[model samples]
Target: MENPAEVLRRVFGHEGFRGLQAGIVAHVMEGGSGLVLMPTGGGKSLCYQVPALCLPGLAVVVSPLIALMEDQVAALRQQGVAAAALHSDLDEEERFEIRRAMARGELRILYVSPERLVMDGTLDNLARREVSLFAIDEAHCVSQWGHHFRPEYRGLTVLAERFPLVPRLALTATADERTVDDIRRQLVLADAPVFRGGFDRPNIFITAEPRETERAQLRAFIKRASDGRGAGIIYCGSRRKTEDTAAWLKQDGHDAMAFHAGMEASAKREAHHRFARGDAVIMCATIAFGMGIDRPDVRWVAHTDLPKSPESWYQEIGRAGRDGLPAQALLLYGPGDIALGRHRIQESPASDEQKRIERGRLEAIVSIAESATCRRRALLRCFGEDLEEDCGACDACATPPKMWNGTVAAQKMLSAVLRTGQRFGLGHIIDVLRGRMTDKIAQHGHDQLPTFGVGKDLPDHTWRGVARQLVSRGALDVAVENHGELLPTDQARPILKGETQLMLRADTVSKASTPRESSAPERGEDPVFDALRQWRRDEARNQGVPAYVIFQDKTLAEIAYRKPRSLDGLAGVPGVGTSKLDKYGDAVLEVLLEAGA
Candidate 1:
């Protein structure tokens, strides 16, 4: 068997192993079973991929995505490793050819979806041979309690029972404690030695903005994130958002394409190819678009709307900086997104118990948005990881905002909503707060209410603050279809009656990173700062890699703050791998010394 370091170089053009990768590979090579919880780009695939090559017989791998299977197979084949996939998308001839190759002992790695794995003869065929290993990729989807539940994935354990000789390895990029346990139980890997890699990626700077005009905001986000350079992903929550944003970006003269389940397969494949070949700058897409893309130069991943949960957020942002370059994770949460997310679960065909769990997950997402504490800490906590302080890479860490007591303000808002029968939305409620006397008020005959105009002292923007903070804090929920229809939640009951207090963080504005009038102390870790940019030419270029893969502004800021001078020192600088250091270290050092770092 090739040494793990040699395995990396031979297969993927890397010359070394990251912290836990070698350990994981060794465990698998020794025929031990385990679960792996690693962040994206942590070499999770290599953990099993290397062992498969060293093992005696065909390694049967289960993946949730056909695109992922095909991409992996192509990459493997590119390196002269024999791999093939069996999926529904393959034609009869393609399927038969794959079967023939496996039967002839010509295929080394066989990839199949969980659905195909559960098919009658698929396991029997694998069981007939040595079947060295079974790898479950994106294993988090197997649990019914999981957000991305796939019923077919539950049948994955059938192979484990039939082919007990094969070592099983379950891997996922974003799974919390509950999700990890769910994967273990569903896949029947009871005593697997779980290998957990660090969730902290200091190179990736995270920020969030409340989405106002979602379309307009997303448009502006896409433009600014490009920083006049390499490709990025703008993930929309729905197909309409994807098509509309992709079209608008094209009209705005950006080289963009749309990818979604709603599009034709050929179009989807074309878009994926265009993105991989660096022909597209931004691919406007729904959740369906990002599953298996292997491109590593993506500089940014922006969520135009809030995702269903932190796991979803982690997975989406994971796509960026795969080549170990610094990336930006810019998330936009429209106030309306919470209701939509919850209503999605509420409307799902599930048992009441499942609905309750789903609702809790949605509520947890909203807390992530509103929390003034460290955003990364809160997120890591959700996934059973604990970080003591703010992660300087996130918004809360970069710009510390102030908190104001909004307990009185929340009481007043809830009183008004309930006093008025809870039928009207924010617009009407705002009107009553400002003492605006209009025909609509008289038509509804709400003017005579005791709470009418009682909130005249609060400004319109202040009222906006009260509303935004309340929703963030879970005192209220907007109607899913009618986001305008704000309703008090059970949480609001005690607060409205003056039983509880609300202290909301005063919103802070983060300025763009440019030469400020006076230098402010820097916060993030970017080895190259002080020097201004070279040109606004095409991004994702330099040293045979994409531009976004270089150094993001936030990372640059961090580097400017903590000037590291050695390889080990620079290694702590987010995204500065041995490969990156070998390629760009001198240039970065020149910038640092020139800037007096």
Candidate 2:
């Protein structure tokens, strides 16, 4: 059998394995089971794919999404590998052909969803074949503590029971310590080695700001980040917001589309198709749109509202910069978003332990948003990884927020919440603090409270910021069952009793200065690069696949920079495997010559 390196070079075109990939491939090839925790775009697929090619029999892969399965199959086929996917979308003829190929040992890899793999007679049929290994993608779904938990994934544990001798690998891009433990226990891979590729995407520039004129902030972010080039995804919290944001962007002359779970299946497919094909399209969507996407040139991702947990936020932002290119992620949120997040956890049917876990996750994300320190460091801490130094890529590291002694302000805010009987929401409490005689304040007789007008020196927005910071600091909580009232937590006692002081970031609309340019190596203006990109776009269009599937932007950039004069010279460039070299190498040389490369 060919070694993993030979398969990687001849098929995948990559010269060498990335971090931990070689170890993972060798382990699986040696009939050892393991768990892999790698960040998105970290070459996690190569870990399993390389071993599957070196192994003896058909390697079965369990994937969660049809789109993900189809995309991988298509890419693998492009490399002249025998790959097939059995999904619900396929017709009977296609399924029959795939089953025949598997039985005849004509296919090297087969992809199936968890539901289909666990169905009656499915495992029985597979048992008849000489199976090599079982790879479970998106393995975090099996854990109840995961952000994207699906009950179907729990059925996957049977793979170990049925194929005890076959090497098994569970892989995910996002998982905390608790979720990791749960995945191991549920999948019964307790004795397997766990390979953790560190969780840091330095190519992604992270930034979060208080929501101030949401449309304006998003528009400015898009312009600054992408300059109207490449693809972007705007995540909204609600279905209606997706539609409204998409429409608004379209009105502003962007090629925008709305996607949500509420859309018809055909509509969602069409939207996904357009996004995959178009170079400069913008997708306004809820969280439903990201997991299945394999497109690598996404230049930016923006969140109009806060994500429910740190895992969700990390995964969502990770969709950008998948090609190891410079990308930006912007998050716009407010106090209401945090309150709603807390309220949802409180109202969930989960047991107290689960609720506590979720609440901690929510608070962790909130800390990331309001943090005055390195955002990347704080984000990595959630996954139990530590960054020794500040990552210069995040907005916080680029432009640190100004912090001030807010002990007096915190006292006033806590006093207002307490004086209002801890039964009023932010708006009403703000009204009382600002000494505004609103009807609700009059009805509650809050104007008579001693804390009334104590904070009148600060503006409404400042007070709102203070309230948000207080909630984040655990000095206050939102009472969702009581109509979103503000309640003090035990941590509030120190500030209320003058036992401790508080330091808060000075919240303002202009907190973030002009962002510094990304530290990533610049792809300078090379006419050769532009011409090659156009040629690639045309070629991809002719083939009816996403442009990146033909060749990633990073590979194209290298080609343009190198200006390889012959097919052999082009093959020397990364991403030019034997299959691609035999297929499109001459065409690439011709384009380069035409462009005076």
Candidate 3:
């Protein structure tokens, strides 16, 4: 068998594996089954991608997302690799051609969504192929206990039962100890070696403010961050948010796109294509947008709302700096963001068990928000891993925000709820505090309540903060279908009856920092470099791994500018090593010197 380094360089155009990847490639190549819990941008895809190429048959990837398959396939084909996908998107003719190719061993890796795999027909068709490896992406979805659980992923174990001779690798960016155990049980990976990569990305810097900066703060953050060094992603929580943010960003003269599942399939595909080509510098999307996106040189990943789990947070942030170059992660949390999350959970149609699990997930997210300790420490601990390095980049590291004991404000907000019969959302409650007797106020007859205008002593913004803080602390619950109809949690009973006291937070607005451009070397907006990176990413995709594992953006820029002429010359570059010279050495060098890399 070829050495791991040789295989990596030849297949992925890289000199060697980063972190646990070399070991992982070795294990998988030796016919070992394993579970890989690598953070996003940690080179998780390469563990199976390179080895699968060296092996003789198809490395069937049981993916939980179809968009992921499309993205990977498009990337792979761009790099001149023989790869295809068998998902619902393909027509019968397309599926038949792909199936024929798989049987003939023309395709190295074929991706299929787990929901499609669960069907007898789809599994039966793929079973006829000479399968060598079975790689499961988003393995956490196999467990119902995971933050984003998918019921269909449970059928993946059927592949193991059916293909006893093929080696397997289950991979995920998110999973705690319990979720990990659940994944093992569901996917039946008892014998797989476990490779857990550390969860810290040193390049990312985390900072948060109260929810008060919804539009204004977001606009300010975007303007300051887009110094035009490289592309970044701004993750919003909903479809509407994505559109609104994307629109606002466009007005600021930035090339941005809004991507969500709510968009038409054609529109989504176009958006993906644009983002992949680096034609757009920023994407304001829901979580769905990042899964299929394996782009390197994504300078940053920011969140406008709180993510549901540390696993999810790490995965989202992991999308940046895949090339191991410096990048940034900006996590913005508002008190209302927490409340909205809780209210939705409390209103879900889940069973008792599901509700309990959901609550646990919510609490875990809160722990990250409330953590005055190292953010990385809290995040890694939640995943059942340890962080030896203190993250000097997050808010906790730079300057921790002082905690607000909103006990009095909580009591006042709770009192308003009790007096108003607990039927209002934050806006109405705020109005009652500011004593604004508007038409809606009169329509609801809330103006007559003794507490209607009692909150007049506090500003509208301060009142809003108090109510949101109360909800985040669990003294109140917002009804789901009714949309933010406030109700008292059992904890509020003591405060209501005077058995316990409450405090209100006086929300403070921080002074805005002057906007500054990024300090990175200015890479000009040359279409040739953009084209070369897209070409390189395409090659990486067909091989079925992340593009960063193939070549970094800096290296891509070097190739685009200098156009290295020989293998020896290629090996002289910063990221290039001996292994890469042998495998992708000639091909990439050709593109660099002449056309595309």
Candidate 4:
């Protein structure tokens, strides 16, 4: 068997391992199992892919989605490795071919969906051959409480029962402490060594704005973020919102498409194909779209509504800058989102324990949105990680927002809710506070209430911010059966009594500051880098593959910056393996030399 490092450089074209990758690979190579929690684009695949190549038998990789399996197998095949994915999408002949290859030990790695792998006789076939190991990707799916729970993933424990000697590796891009523990229990990986990689993605600039005009803010953000030169994803909360937003973008002359589980399979497939194959296209989608996407060059991710939890938000935003380039993540939320989210949770039939856990998760995300501290710091804290210093890339650290003590405002809002018998929504409460003598106020009798019009000096947005912050801070609650009417919680008693002070971001109408333009000079400014990218794209198209499959943008940028003059020099750069050096080195050198000339 080949060494892991040798396989990494020769096949994947990376010079060495990153973070816990080396240690994890060694453990697995010694027939040990482990659970790996790494950030998106943090090279999680190498933990398994390298070990699969180094091991003896057919490495069975349990993947959740067919698209993810297909993409991974495609990239591995490009490196001259014998890899194949078995899924429902394949024809009988293709399945037979793959089966024959596995039987003959011609395949190094075989990707199978969890459902298929757990089917009757699947383990029998693998047992006939030298089954090297089992790798479970998206292992967090086993956690029933996780954001993207897959019941099928829980059945993956069978791999350990049947193939007792085969090492198992479970990998995920996002998981909190609870999800991690649940994964261990469900996937039977408790005995496996756990490797927790850093959750930080400094390459992605995080910013969120309180919704003013949702569409207008999104349009401006798109203009500022990608400038129509890169690809991106815009996440909408509902299926209808995704379709409408996509249609709106198309009308604005953007090359955009809508994708959601609600769409027909063929239509969703077409949309996925277009975004994967083309550059600078915007995909307006629900949360259904990104989990299986392996496209590495996506430049930005935007959310038109609140993500359910900090974990989900971080994973969604982590999709950007997968190629290690600068990227942006922008979220726009309003009080309605908070209300809607609470209503959804309250109306659900989930167990009380699950609901309580989910509510805590939601509150954490709300805190991140309303935070005056570093966005990265708040986000990382939710996952049990901490940054010693603020990340200068996020909106808060870039331009500190002004904060004001909202203790008095909190008391007024809570008093209005209480005095109104806690039967009104924010709008009615705001109307009461602004002293609007509407028919409803008159009918409720006597604008003589002590709290009415007390908030007249505050703008509508300011009041909205205060109310949402109260809900986020547990001082206020939304009554589910009452159409999300505001109600004070026990926590509100302290704040109302002046024992607990509330501090909130003051400029409610002001948006989060846009991240500074990347200080590193644009790659396009270097002709050789541009030429190399063009060459990679052409090569990728000719081979019918994604450009990153040929060489990552990071690798190409390094090549351009180093301007290697010979094949030997090119081989010395990261991502230039012996095979790639032999296949494309001359072509790359010619492009670089011609650009220099």
Please provide, for model 2 over 348-444, each residue's C-alpha lDDT reduced to its tens digit, 9 standing for 90 to 100: 8999999998888888899899999899999999988999899888888888888888999889888888878888888888888889988988888
Q: Against the correct fold, how does model 2 do in TM-score?
A: 0.94
Give residue 413's error in model 4 in angstroms: 3.8
Model 2 segments more than 4 A misplaced: 414-457, 478-493, 513-519
Q: Candidate 4's error at 145, in angstroms? A: 2.7
Query: How many residue pairs clash in model 1?
Result: 13
Q: Model 1 over residues 19-49: C-alpha lDDT tens digits?
A: 8888888888888888998988777888888
Candidate 2, overall lDDT?
0.88
- Candidate 4: which pairs clash? 13-575
TM-score of each: 0.81, 0.94, 0.81, 0.92
Against the true structure, candidate 3 has what lDDT?
A: 0.73
Model 4 clashing-pair count: 1
Deviation in Å, model 2, residue 140 alpha carbon? 0.4
**Candidate 4, after superposition: displacement of residue 450 in Å?**
6.4
Which 10-residue window of candidate 3 scores lowest in summed lDDT?
511-520
- Whole-model lDDT per candidate: 0.73, 0.88, 0.73, 0.85
Which one is best on TM-score?
A: 2
Query: Candidate order by lDDT, highest to lowest?
Result: 2, 4, 1, 3
Q: Tell me the alpha-carbon RMSD of every candidate.
A: 6.9, 2.4, 5.1, 2.7
